[model samples]
Target: GAGVSQSPRYKVAKRGQDVALRCDPISGHVSLFWYQQALGQGPEFLTYFQNEAQLDKSGLPSDRFFAERPEGSVSTLKIQRTQQEDSAVYLCASSGGHHSNQPQHFGDGTRLSIL
Candidate 1:
Protein backbone atom coordinates (compact mmCIF):
# COMPACT_ATOMS: atom_id res chain seq x y z
CA GLY A 1 0.00 0.00 0.00
CA ALA A 2 1.05 3.57 -0.53
CA GLY A 3 2.59 5.51 2.33
CA VAL A 4 1.67 9.05 3.33
CA SER A 5 2.92 11.81 1.01
CA GLN A 6 2.91 15.58 0.94
CA SER A 7 3.44 18.10 -1.86
CA PRO A 8 6.05 20.75 -2.56
CA ARG A 9 8.35 19.31 0.16
CA TYR A 10 9.38 22.94 0.32
CA LYS A 11 7.54 26.21 -0.23
CA VAL A 12 8.47 29.87 -0.11
CA ALA A 13 5.74 32.44 0.31
CA LYS A 14 5.59 36.16 0.86
CA ARG A 15 3.91 37.55 3.89
CA GLY A 16 0.14 38.01 3.61
CA GLN A 17 -0.24 35.37 0.90
CA ASP A 18 -2.08 32.13 1.32
CA VAL A 19 -0.72 28.63 0.75
CA ALA A 20 -2.22 25.18 0.68
CA LEU A 21 -0.29 22.00 1.37
CA ARG A 22 -1.60 18.58 0.45
CA CYS A 23 -1.30 15.23 2.17
CA ASP A 24 -2.15 11.76 0.90
CA PRO A 25 -2.41 9.21 3.65
CA ILE A 26 -1.70 5.53 3.33
CA SER A 27 -4.31 3.52 1.50
CA GLY A 28 -7.02 2.01 3.71
CA HIS A 29 -5.95 3.91 6.77
CA VAL A 30 -8.81 5.16 8.95
CA SER A 31 -7.26 8.10 10.74
CA LEU A 32 -5.19 11.08 9.63
CA PHE A 33 -3.48 13.91 11.46
CA TRP A 34 -1.57 17.11 10.80
CA TYR A 35 1.26 18.52 12.84
CA GLN A 36 3.55 21.52 12.74
CA GLN A 37 7.20 21.45 13.70
CA ALA A 38 9.40 24.45 14.11
CA LEU A 39 13.18 24.33 14.27
CA GLY A 40 14.49 22.36 17.24
CA GLN A 41 11.02 21.62 18.53
CA GLY A 42 8.81 18.56 18.61
CA PRO A 43 5.85 18.32 16.30
CA GLU A 44 2.72 19.95 17.62
CA PHE A 45 -0.72 18.52 16.85
CA LEU A 46 -2.70 20.66 14.47
CA THR A 47 -5.87 18.81 13.60
CA TYR A 48 -7.19 15.33 12.94
CA PHE A 49 -9.70 13.55 10.75
CA GLN A 50 -11.20 10.14 10.88
CA ASN A 51 -12.64 9.06 7.56
CA GLU A 52 -13.71 12.51 6.44
CA ALA A 53 -14.91 13.68 9.82
CA GLN A 54 -12.66 16.12 11.61
CA LEU A 55 -12.51 14.78 15.15
CA ASP A 56 -10.10 17.25 16.70
CA LYS A 57 -8.83 20.68 15.71
CA SER A 58 -7.96 22.15 19.06
CA GLY A 59 -4.30 22.44 18.13
CA LEU A 60 -4.76 24.87 15.30
CA PRO A 61 -2.57 27.87 15.97
CA SER A 62 -4.90 30.53 14.64
CA ASP A 63 -7.88 31.23 12.43
CA ARG A 64 -5.51 31.57 9.49
CA PHE A 65 -4.98 27.85 9.56
CA PHE A 66 -7.56 25.46 8.15
CA ALA A 67 -7.61 21.78 7.28
CA GLU A 68 -9.94 19.29 5.69
CA ARG A 69 -10.40 15.66 4.75
CA PRO A 70 -13.27 15.44 2.31
CA GLU A 71 -12.83 11.80 1.28
CA GLY A 72 -11.30 10.46 4.49
CA SER A 73 -8.13 9.59 2.60
CA VAL A 74 -6.62 12.77 1.26
CA SER A 75 -6.31 15.92 3.32
CA THR A 76 -5.20 19.48 2.89
CA LEU A 77 -3.85 22.24 5.11
CA LYS A 78 -4.31 25.85 4.15
CA ILE A 79 -2.71 28.84 5.76
CA GLN A 80 -3.96 32.34 5.18
CA ARG A 81 -2.01 35.57 5.55
CA THR A 82 1.35 33.95 5.75
CA GLN A 83 3.82 35.41 8.19
CA GLN A 84 7.47 34.87 9.00
CA GLU A 85 6.31 33.23 12.19
CA ASP A 86 4.39 30.68 10.17
CA SER A 87 7.46 29.13 8.68
CA ALA A 88 7.77 25.49 9.66
CA VAL A 89 7.44 21.92 8.52
CA TYR A 90 3.88 20.70 8.16
CA LEU A 91 3.73 16.94 8.64
CA CYS A 92 0.91 14.50 8.01
CA ALA A 93 0.42 11.10 9.51
CA SER A 94 -1.97 8.16 9.45
CA SER A 95 -2.89 5.35 11.76
CA GLY A 96 -5.26 2.39 11.96
CA GLY A 97 -6.65 2.78 15.45
CA HIS A 98 -9.35 5.10 16.77
CA HIS A 99 -7.75 5.82 20.10
CA SER A 100 -5.24 8.63 20.46
CA ASN A 101 -2.59 6.16 21.45
CA GLN A 102 -2.41 4.73 17.95
CA PRO A 103 1.06 5.33 16.58
CA GLN A 104 1.17 7.35 13.36
CA HIS A 105 3.43 7.04 10.35
CA PHE A 106 4.56 10.45 9.23
CA GLY A 107 5.47 12.01 5.93
CA ASP A 108 8.62 14.05 5.48
CA GLY A 109 6.47 17.19 5.41
CA THR A 110 6.08 20.38 3.45
CA ARG A 111 8.53 23.00 4.63
CA LEU A 112 7.01 26.43 4.32
CA SER A 113 8.96 29.66 4.44
CA ILE A 114 7.37 33.05 4.70
CA LEU A 115 9.69 35.67 3.33
Candidate 2:
Protein backbone atom coordinates (compact mmCIF):
# COMPACT_ATOMS: atom_id res chain seq x y z
CA GLY A 1 0.00 0.00 0.00
CA ALA A 2 1.27 3.42 -0.94
CA GLY A 3 0.75 5.72 2.01
CA VAL A 4 1.81 9.26 2.69
CA SER A 5 5.55 9.97 2.89
CA GLN A 6 7.25 12.58 5.03
CA SER A 7 10.87 13.65 4.94
CA PRO A 8 13.40 14.02 7.74
CA ARG A 9 11.85 11.73 10.34
CA TYR A 10 13.65 13.89 12.88
CA LYS A 11 15.01 17.41 12.82
CA VAL A 12 17.27 19.26 15.21
CA ALA A 13 17.56 23.00 14.99
CA LYS A 14 18.76 25.78 17.17
CA ARG A 15 16.51 28.59 18.28
CA GLY A 16 15.69 31.05 15.48
CA GLN A 17 16.62 28.50 12.84
CA ASP A 18 14.33 27.98 9.88
CA VAL A 19 13.16 24.55 8.79
CA ALA A 20 11.12 23.18 5.94
CA LEU A 21 9.16 19.95 6.15
CA ARG A 22 7.97 17.97 3.17
CA CYS A 23 4.90 15.79 2.74
CA ASP A 24 3.87 13.49 -0.07
CA PRO A 25 0.29 12.41 0.22
CA ILE A 26 -1.28 9.33 -1.30
CA SER A 27 -1.72 9.66 -5.02
CA GLY A 28 -4.90 11.41 -6.10
CA HIS A 29 -5.84 12.53 -2.64
CA VAL A 30 -7.55 15.90 -2.84
CA SER A 31 -7.59 17.01 0.74
CA LEU A 32 -4.45 17.74 2.72
CA PHE A 33 -3.86 18.89 6.26
CA TRP A 34 -0.98 19.77 8.58
CA TYR A 35 -1.07 19.12 12.30
CA GLN A 36 1.09 19.55 15.34
CA GLN A 37 1.19 17.08 18.19
CA ALA A 38 2.82 17.73 21.53
CA LEU A 39 3.91 15.21 24.11
CA GLY A 40 0.96 13.31 25.59
CA GLN A 41 -1.47 15.28 23.51
CA GLY A 42 -3.56 14.77 20.42
CA PRO A 43 -2.72 16.38 17.12
CA GLU A 44 -3.89 19.94 16.64
CA PHE A 45 -4.86 21.22 13.22
CA LEU A 46 -2.47 23.75 11.71
CA THR A 47 -3.71 24.08 8.19
CA TYR A 48 -5.87 22.52 5.47
CA PHE A 49 -5.95 22.53 1.72
CA GLN A 50 -8.25 21.19 -0.96
CA ASN A 51 -6.18 20.50 -4.04
CA GLU A 52 -4.19 23.61 -4.88
CA ALA A 53 -6.38 25.85 -2.81
CA GLN A 54 -5.52 26.51 0.82
CA LEU A 55 -8.96 26.81 2.37
CA ASP A 56 -8.03 27.25 6.02
CA LYS A 57 -5.04 28.29 8.10
CA SER A 58 -6.42 29.73 11.29
CA GLY A 59 -4.79 27.03 13.32
CA LEU A 60 -1.32 28.29 12.55
CA PRO A 61 0.22 29.73 15.69
CA SER A 62 1.97 32.63 14.03
CA ASP A 63 2.91 34.31 10.77
CA ARG A 64 6.20 32.42 10.75
CA PHE A 65 4.47 29.21 9.75
CA PHE A 66 3.57 28.73 6.11
CA ALA A 67 2.16 25.86 4.04
CA GLU A 68 1.40 25.34 0.40
CA ARG A 69 0.28 22.75 -2.14
CA PRO A 70 1.28 24.39 -5.40
CA GLU A 71 0.62 21.31 -7.58
CA GLY A 72 -2.10 19.72 -5.50
CA SER A 73 0.04 16.71 -4.67
CA VAL A 74 3.23 17.46 -2.79
CA SER A 75 3.08 19.93 0.07
CA THR A 76 5.58 21.81 2.16
CA LEU A 77 5.40 23.33 5.62
CA LYS A 78 7.94 25.99 6.54
CA ILE A 79 8.64 27.51 9.89
CA GLN A 80 10.78 30.60 10.26
CA ARG A 81 12.69 31.76 13.33
CA THR A 82 11.78 28.60 15.14
CA GLN A 83 11.32 28.85 18.87
CA GLN A 84 11.58 26.29 21.63
CA GLU A 85 7.81 26.12 21.95
CA ASP A 86 7.66 25.01 18.31
CA SER A 87 9.16 21.67 19.20
CA ALA A 88 6.73 18.91 18.35
CA VAL A 89 5.75 16.30 15.79
CA TYR A 90 4.56 17.79 12.56
CA LEU A 91 2.14 15.51 10.75
CA CYS A 92 0.77 15.46 7.26
CA ALA A 93 -2.56 13.83 6.42
CA SER A 94 -4.61 13.30 3.31
CA SER A 95 -8.07 11.97 2.54
CA GLY A 96 -10.13 11.24 -0.53
CA GLY A 97 -11.76 14.63 -0.46
CA HIS A 98 -14.38 16.89 1.07
CA HIS A 99 -17.25 15.27 -0.81
CA SER A 100 -15.98 11.81 -0.10
CA ASN A 101 -16.10 9.97 3.20
CA GLN A 102 -12.60 8.48 3.04
CA PRO A 103 -10.69 8.57 6.27
CA GLN A 104 -7.50 10.55 6.50
CA HIS A 105 -4.18 8.78 6.08
CA PHE A 106 -1.23 10.17 8.03
CA GLY A 107 2.50 10.00 7.58
CA ASP A 108 5.02 9.02 10.22
CA GLY A 109 5.62 12.70 10.91
CA THR A 110 8.75 14.75 11.55
CA ARG A 111 9.77 15.34 15.11
CA LEU A 112 11.32 18.78 15.44
CA SER A 113 13.63 19.58 18.29
CA ILE A 114 14.47 23.18 19.03
CA LEU A 115 17.56 23.85 21.01
Q: Estimate each model's TM-score.
A: 0.95, 0.96
- Judged by lDDT, which candidate is best? 2
The collision pairs in model 2 are none
Task: Identify the leading candidate in terms of TM-score.
Answer: 2
lDDT of each: 0.94, 0.95
**What is the alpha-carbon RMSD of candidate 1 to the true structure?**
1.1
Please give the range of 10 consecutive residues that has the lowest summed lDDT in model 1. 94-103
**Per-residue lDDT of candidate 2, residues 2-74 (tens digit):** 9999998999999999999999999989999999999999999999999999999999999999999999999
- Which regions of candidate 1 are displaced past 4 Å? none
Query: For model 1, how does the per-residue alpha-carbon lDDT over 8-57 read when each residue is reduced to its tens digit?
Result: 89999999999999999888889999999999999999999999999999
- What TM-score does candidate 2 get on C-alpha atoms? 0.96
Output candidate 2 Cα RMSD: 1.2
State the displacement of the C-alpha of residue 109, model 1, in Å, after optimal TM-score superposition: 0.3
Give stretches of model 2 more than 4 Å off: 98-101
